[model samples]
Target: MPVAVGSYGQTQPSCFDRVKMGFMMGFAVGMAAGAMFGTFSCLRVGMRGRELMGGVGKTMLQSGGTFGTFMSIGMGIRC
Candidate 1:
């Protein structure tokens, strides 16, 4: 199907294509958010474990969680 160049170039993308692309982009972002959360959680746990084994780790899990959430939001992460 040949499209006239000027009209084709100006055409808006269809709704279905927009929805599919949005879903794909959001999915990638969601995966990145999940990874970030998992890593932060694991780090917190390791720090907690270290407290018992004798390392001078501060109790900053709450701050870390807040930081992670804010960063994800700043990155425009969406479902």
Candidate 2:
């Protein structure tokens, strides 16, 4: 009798898994982009100290959430 080998690419991830992965990736990218843009824009507007921090944080969260939602939807549809 021949022994069977284990296969690595046999299973497909669930829809929720795909969506979660997409959301996490998109959120990370969005947060980085938002931070860069927010910092520059806030500085240009003369925001300083706590105000700048607040603005940047807000921008990061909003952009991250938006990107995550869209990504999750797209990924879910692929499954």
lDDT: worst 10-residue window of model 2? 1-10
Cα lDDT of candidate 2 equals 0.89
Tens digit of per-residue lDDT, candidate 1, span 1-79: 4433565477544455555555555555555555566557656667556553332222234344444445445444432
Deviation of model 2 at 40, angstroms: 1.1
Candidate 2: residue pairs that collide: none
**Candidate 1 vs. true structure, TM-score:** 0.41
Stretches off by above 4 angstroms in model 2 are 1-10
TM-score of each: 0.41, 0.85
The true-versus-predicted C-alpha distance at residue 74 of model 2, in Å, is 0.9
Error of 2 at 25 (Å): 0.7
Query: What does candidate 1 score in Cα RMSD to the true structure?
Result: 10.5
Q: Quote the lDDT for 6 in model 2.
A: 46
Q: Quickly count the clashes in candidate 2.
A: 0
lDDT of each: 0.49, 0.89
